[model samples]
Target: MPRIRSSPNSSLPNPNAPPITTTTISTTTIHTNTTVDPAAAAVAGFFNNLLNKIPLPRWAIYTIFACGALLILLICLCICKKCCCKGKKKKRQKKTDEKINLNGVNGKTTTALVQPDVTDVDYGATKEKQRGKFLYSLEYKAAQSELIVGIKQANSLKAMDLGGTSDPYVKVYILPDKSRTCETKVFRNTLNPVFNEQFTFQISKSSLLNSTAVMQVFDFNRFSKHNIIGELRLQLCDVDWNHVIEEWQDLAGPAKFEEENLGEICFSLRYVPTAGKLTVVILEAKNMKSMDIGGSSDPYVKVQLALDKRKWKKRKTSIKKKTLNPYYNESFTFDVSFEQIQRVNLVISVWDHDAMTRNDAMGKIFLGCDASGNQLRHWADMLSNPRRPVAQWHNLLSAEQVNSTLTLKKKIPLASKLPF
Candidate 1:
């Protein structure tokens, strides 16, 4: 249905009237709100400046800084750990010392070789600084050859225990003749112990001029070696013997050693197979080396027995002061099996004591199944007579020579042919 009609609305004749075109104007404004931190900016700027100045890559520089920081942290940790460990050790040591002190105060005995908390320098200084005094009275009766001694008390004695006190006892003896020795009862936990004790010694009037009275203060230890606090020595010749003389004497250290001559020793030996007991008695020593400036010596005996020549057991005798020919009738016993007796060596030695220095060895002697001459004879005698003590005198050899000879190994004899 198409009818051809002229449509005036479709005409394009409005071109001049106002080709009033369409004008579209779009206005848009964007606002940005952001803030920057000054510290972060400064840090970033510093890092950027550093990175720019260095020739290395950023990753390499950052790795180096990280490693340096880690190392610093590790070092700080180690220092802190060491400081903590040191603090702990100090605390533990203090606690142990306090415990020992408490035990000593409670009359309980603690066995130790030495004080673990004290150094040698500090111990020496303490020992030298504090040496106390003792009171004593002496009387000599010329008619009865009796010398009476009284140990009244001690004051301001050195503190030798952890409790800052001492369990003290007194030892009184006559020098040059130590056959008679006396000791007082132990007083516990005290720096001032009063021991009102008396003792008597038998000596002729003629022997007084050559004898000296020696008194020693010692700290008692039940399970270990005792410690000597101090000592006092008085020449009997200087004392007036007619009346009882009482005085307080200041304690002193032992005298230093001087050179003298070599010595000789005599001893006895006995063995019993039934009871496994072997006895050795140290008899006497002669011509001992003088250790003091006053031309006298303080000598002690040490007897040692070697099983298989390597495992050795030893015993010691008391010291005899101011004598060249000293007598020590001390005895020692050992448990030796029947099989072990044949492979044994007995060594007897003499030593000079020095309080300020190491003890000096004067001489020594050894006897065994491998020995010769007098030593062999003595061994044979001891083995031939079981349970009967046989004694003899032997010349002491020099330390160097004896040490060389003792290192020699000899075949152990059979039990059947072991001089028995």
Candidate 2:
């Protein structure tokens, strides 16, 4: 008969816990006297019992022991792999959760949309999760040839600087036509902000049906360049034009570079290296965007030479009334040295006049594509051939985003040899 035995002098592993199962080898408790795994010891005992019953040889018994040991090691390895996989899965989950939870500027927690895996294939380099959200309404009035949008509020914006919160602002434009860009006022520090602002763009019914509304969220920085947070794009024709449609949409990664084709701007460039003067003339814009209450736009040119002070070149064209294709023929001169031209960039912007509100940017081009690629070619060509007027047409771009709004030729440094 198989006899079971227990050690009367042994103490419980935990005094408060119930008794656990242990292996009994004849007259001894194998669990207490040895550190070997209970399951492994049990397997050994089973093998011994089988050998005794069948009268197996010592070498065969040793072979069974080796197989049992290898099985135990395989089990341990499998358990370790499972545990490692589970730990990795939990870590990934935690990171995804952090991306969705946003702490508000006022110490209140904010939230965002479905988090996507950020990788080099995602936004290219940084793993910065996409954030910020806002509520908006859209309506198109065919009778008035207008597209009206109401920007209501924003929430849980991501901070772009060490200050820990961002100064948030909104810029809206009708795609394929950058002749007009409408924007909201900057809300300082607070991630949760109320805008409650309405904007109207004068686009004809035919053009409005094919237009897409591109709204970009940006962090306003006083001393540095404003950073783009995210963008929301929607086809204007897809919305029900007859009624006001309001929805809370999450800001998505900006994809403005492809086919946004926001029309074009044409201007002339003449650089006189002898006089150290760069003269830029805004001739007119073809297929421009319209921004107005009056079926047409009151457009003007805004020029700025990004210099040491970043001070405005302090020159702009008078507002031309009621036309998408506004003819300015306005000339602006910059007193710049040949060397200064390489380091400096020109920001030529067209804006819509609004007496009641801040003027809205229609579209922009830069002498250096580093800013906006719209006018980089004209600037490069003028420098390539000295003492000659270089005129060209530039495709208007929305601005910088997850994807650049324009395809720009690299800004080659002016021929190292100065024209002078």
Candidate 3:
């Protein structure tokens, strides 16, 4: 016989109390000697039921924890993104305000301001002003025989017609190198004109030769004693002199000489120390008949002496037409003060007024005194004529003559030295 115990929570037999099974039921006997602890069984039964109700795997619990962490990180990132966007928006707004303030202070309008193009104004007036300190904007154009440069103010401000005080002057600077700055004045105007003015600069070949090699312009007012004005650069290049001459050849054609062989002319001077008179003997090789000097109405030769290599002392001598033979001769006597002159250089150039040309008949001669006046050294070129003839003429003086006259053996001593 088996005995069973019951729990108070449910009507179930406790296993710890006893075991009951129906094996054979023919003859059965009941025995009640076993005891069971109900309190412990109830607790154990509660735990077993809880475990069965909540059946969770180890991997599922770990997955839930990881998911919770990811959700928390996502929430933090969203908050940071919002904060950064707000900050950037505030900074951009501040910059915009600053830009607006700057524009307002400068008196700048929202509308587009029409600026003046400086290329429209006259370059002549501007060029003159550029020689001074005034800043100028210039545009240049080169033609067949003319060069034009235009200039105007760089700013678009209406020319103010301020009275005498606002006398505007244009200055131009001729800058050859880093060391030299030559300035020239171009134009002056008291009243401001509505339209830009144009000035013309006319330069012949001779004038162009005297002009500066390079030119620049600047504003004079801007170049105060305390400050220097900005410089505008200009370049002059490719000067064709032959083309210029050809353009003006019609006006100058009649003056050209027609001589085939222009004879050579040479001279020797002897200074008399005792009398203070210089004796000059003229030398000519060919007959004056062949030299057709363009119908010379004023056919004369002028002899000039340079005292200090600076200013010339002049002497005039007339050449008689057809009076002398192929070999001509003339003499001249002049008084020179030795004290006033350190040395005298003689230059004899031939002039034909009708032909409008001057030919260098001979080179320079230096005159000084020795005792006898016979020891005067004549530094004359031995060539038959001037080596560099202007027209189609050849020199007749031989090399030996040039060398012999240039040496000391042919020098003549002066009888007496002049006072000054």
Candidate 4:
């Protein structure tokens, strides 16, 4: 009986279940499950398939990487080649422009033989056509002292005085203490005169060292009885030879420069008027390497003196590499006396085997004497001292006794006042 009663509600709603409400309730629950886009899914599937199914050999991977690197290198090389080619083209254009510019300029051309022997050049040419008409003055000062002289012009006419007379040549005189003297010119011009032509004097360092001992200028052709036309006085201070030697030592390092198996270098001393005696020394540096000759043969040193713009003396000596050190310490000496000399020029050279090939060093010195017997010399040291006194002339005297019966004209002073 009980089993029959419970079966009554199996197919139908029970009447006691709170009126058996038939309302339907709808509910939606959101669960956050990661959703993949179609594109992303496809990419993932592609990678999975590749990693899982496609088995690439190590050698194949290496080969592919190497090929990619080679391709990149080829691209870089191509870029470099293009850049280099462009650069070369630009350089060629620049060269062409320079050549055009050079062609447009007025220039004189000189051809010289390679490594030719040292030769002297005369300032005065016998022919008037070869003579130029330029004059130069050089001054130096040191420690409140001054040295002044006329610089000789190359290939030029001799300097002239105010009256158009040729001036005396200037010379440099050096003392044993390394002090110097400046020379004076006899002819006086109204300060600087205008010349029709131009000239240049060449001086180098080696020659300068030798002649720095003394320097002077003089006027050889005096229209008036007075011999001195212009005088330059130089005082030199702070010319530390020790410092120069120290600098040379620093430059040369510990290397010893000495000539081996070579005979003593010789020099001839000569006298110039209005200039004093000069002692010259010549020494050669040896034991040099082949490269020291500047990659050429026929290396040599030259020495010279210049008088005015028209006179010069030259001296030279051959260099032996086997006897030269990498450092140069060779030197030369000459005893030159100046009876009335004015200007002195010194030049040195290193010769190359090729025709007309030479490297040179030069210098100048000046000397002068005043009525007070004060001597003046000029060189680089003069630039520091400028207070030195120049030479002055005294009143001319009559050699003969004046007769009481005859009245004589008073002698006029001819020379200009000395410039201190």
Candidate 5:
């Protein structure tokens, strides 16, 4: 029999030698044998050889392997935890970025129509904030630097100044340029003043969205300062500039809008350049001053056009009775050449018609550059560019003489100081 010895698989490898395998066998003719998986056996053998080479005891070596496995597990857990935290941080950063995009200080823009046109209010589309009728039209001419506004008229209004009458006039301007655009003529003691007047503004279309139309109504006063009865402010952006929109609007007043507006007016104008004629249509006046002892006074529009220096041609609308605001729809024409258009002056005076006494001058206005700066501008625009109709509301002069009163008022007080 050949002498045989088995070496353990736990022994370290020799240089330039093949792999080792070990087994225990009992030769009793009833042999017992066992085999392990190649891959599993190789892994176990590698650990076993590594442990056998260590100088530590078997128990100590086993302890070191167990601790090393535990340490590896702890490191994996730490790395996984760090990865999870990093993922959450990334999610938080994404959310923060979205929040900044949705809301910012410089991101807000005005979209709602601030104050809209007031017309025959439907009462259906109205909110609690919608008080009056809103009706107006705006045309934006970007190249011309102009804004054209057409205001027809207002219906029912509250009387503020007098017992049952208000000398209502409309003054409009684009805010941030509060120099004052133009004002409608006062209807006299009547609540309603017909101003079928068209107004124009020299404004760039680009600035309209940021600009607003500020309108205020005032009662005309010859002796006292005009009192602000109410106001109507409108935003340009809200208007549908494409189509002409008309609706009834309630006029809002400054804090103390005590009562209803007095009334409104209607008037139109035409300029025939070739014919050398300037025609003014005095539609109507309502709620006028009562020159009578008890009842409402007869009211009419006294129309005058300055033909030459120290000469003013006069025309009159039919007298209306009882009611404060009278309607005349009467058209008056004056001889005006293209050259004379600038030189001639149009003066409109509202008078109280009295059967017994002389007609009392209620209110008069010089419609031109000399008085209403816009009048001359309007005249120039019409003559230079004729044929097209141009209309606007002109504020009536508080003084009977629109041209002279301003300088006279200034000089009347200064006379005492002028070398006395």
Candidate 6:
């Protein structure tokens, strides 16, 4: 039994065990008419050759390709998201701006330099809105009790000069007390002027309701009086003090700007304390009212010294006939002691000389220690610099306006009031 042992690798059948019956298992593979793409095959072959050339394992190659494909897909998605967000943000901002311009917070359209919708413009309103618009800012500071005003710029102003442009400036006044005033520098030959100027008004919270701000745009003239282009009056009671108020407002026609055109005069003053002498040189006068027919005047200046609100001494300059702007360049001296200078007031009255009738008072101005505004300042300047001449330009006022401002002792007789 040990002599004949069958090996596992032997091809002959082993007879040691009982007779074995083998059963055959059959399998069927169905053949369909599916077509193979040559392009796909070439691509697959190219990738296969590329992957085979790499030293890494097959698993690492497959992981790298999968990671690369996922990274590219994520980048594309991020770009698309950013573009969509930017477009949406722009549209939203545009819509918000339009809404603000159309319907402002306080029911008034606070349209700035941006034009409002055509439907929002009221056709029944005055046509002065088409004249121009100005930009400004107002801020109320509660801590300091101040109203800070900023005059930014103006656009499309009317031209008053012969040229097709305008020399413009801005005047800011706090009314009904117009003592507080600020003026901007004149910009020459421009329809649109930028006045980056600021002014401060000392206003308490209690007075805010009663306060009003007047901003006047004026056309500057070298030879004639300045003409008011337009104006904007804003009442402080209508403002919201929670934040700054900044807007572009349409300019309206000035109602009472004619009073501002009373005209201006330029003169120099010199006071010598040791000599007790005060000299006044009438340099020039411009924009005087035309008192005579044919729109001209025979103008002359009457300078008088007033002590205790009564006329003490007076002098006159030769009349410049038929001239609105007269150049006098004449100097007059007065015996004014240092003690008397404090109470003395210099009265300048411009008169139109007439042969047939009484002289007409064109305008008048007074300068003294008790004078208000520019008059007081000018008098102080002359006193501060003794013996040195100080020159200034003063705005003239009507006779009634002058009388209302001065604290006069009594009315002068008509004989002494003559300009001859």
- The most accurate candidate by TM-score is 6
- Candidate 3, residue 298: how far the Cα is off, in Å: 7.5
Please identify model 5 stretches exceeding 4 Å from their true place. Answer: 1-265, 307-309, 373-385, 401-403, 406-420
Query: Once model 6 is optimally superposed onto the true structure by TM-score, how far is the C-alpha of residue 307 displaced, in angstroms?
Result: 1.0
Largest lDDT belongs to which candidate?
6
TM-score (all chains, Cα) for each model: 0.37, 0.36, 0.23, 0.20, 0.36, 0.45
lDDT of each: 0.79, 0.70, 0.39, 0.36, 0.63, 0.83
* Full candidate order by TM-score, most accurate first: 6, 1, 2, 5, 3, 4
lDDT (C-alpha) at residue 325 in model 1: 90
Q: Could you tell me how far off, in angstroms, the CA of residue 130 lies in candidate 2 after the best superposition?
A: 4.9
In the range 1-420, model 6's lDDT, one tens digit per residue, is 124333455677788966655545556668899899999999999999998999999999889989999999999999999999999999999999999766665544455336766654665244786568999999999999989999999999988888888888887877665545556767889989988888887788988889889998988664445678999989999999899988999998886643456567888999999999999999998888888888999999999888878777899999999999999999999999998898899989899999999999998889887665456667887999999999877777766556655656664457666332
Q: Comparing 2 and 4 by TM-score, which wins?
A: 2
- Candidate 2 structure quality by residue, lDDT tens digits, 1-420: 486766445574668666666666665445656567999999999977877886778888789889999999999999999999999999999987877554323343232223333442566433334376778989878789888888888787777767778887787877786556555767778778788888788889888878888878877653334577877889877777667899887777767584454456777788889888988888887666766766677788877776432433558888887788788888888898877777666766778898889988776666652432224435666888877877776555555521133233333334573333
Q: Compare candidates 3 and 5 on TM-score and give the better one.
A: 5
Q: Give the better candidate number (3 or 6) by TM-score.
A: 6
Please state the error at residue 381 of candidate 6 in Å. Answer: 1.0
- Supply every candidate's count of residue pairs whose N, Cα or C atoms clash at under 3 angstroms: 1, 2, 52, 116, 55, 0
What C-alpha root-mean-square deviation, in Å, does candidate 1 show against the real structure? 18.9
Root-mean-square deviation of candidate 3? 29.0
